[model samples]
Target: MKKITDEQLNQYLEIRIKLGEENFKFINACYDEVLLLKKEEATKNIKFEITDFSKFRDFAKK
Candidate 1:
């Protein structure tokens, strides 16, 4: 399995369309999976700390 960029996927889709290929659904599914994985990978390193919920509660009451 080769890693492909979003641009590459779009280009390939264009070529497939031009050639009248029938695998558009499959390719779009792969593209969607790639985007999801990319989003997950990007957020994997994020860290959150909730040290003050009281402030949020006060704000919500207003």
Candidate 2:
């Protein structure tokens, strides 16, 4: 089994907390499915592609 990095774990935790329990589970399930594709590869790479909220702040005026 590959070792999940501490940074990835922390990011996951932050995402979970921000999303709350209900949404957290749903997001986690999606991630799990993606991870399944790289089973036991000894190097797990979890990258989060989140857009900055400030980028959309201008849209609020519309």
By TM-score, the best candidate is: 2
Q: Candidate 2, which segments miss by more than 4 Å at Cα? A: 32-62
Question: Model 2, 26: alpha-carbon shift in Å?
Answer: 1.4
What is the number of residue pairs that collide in model 1?
0
Candidates in order have lDDT scores of 0.83, 0.76
- Ten contiguous residues minimizing lDDT sum, candidate 2: 40-49
Q: Write the per-residue lDDT of candidate 1 for residues 1-62, one digit (tens) a residue.
A: 79999999999878788756567667778889999999999989976469667777899899
The list of candidate 1 runs beyond 4 A from truth reads: 1-14, 18-21, 47-62
Candidate No. with top lDDT: 1
Pairs with steric clashes in candidate 2: none
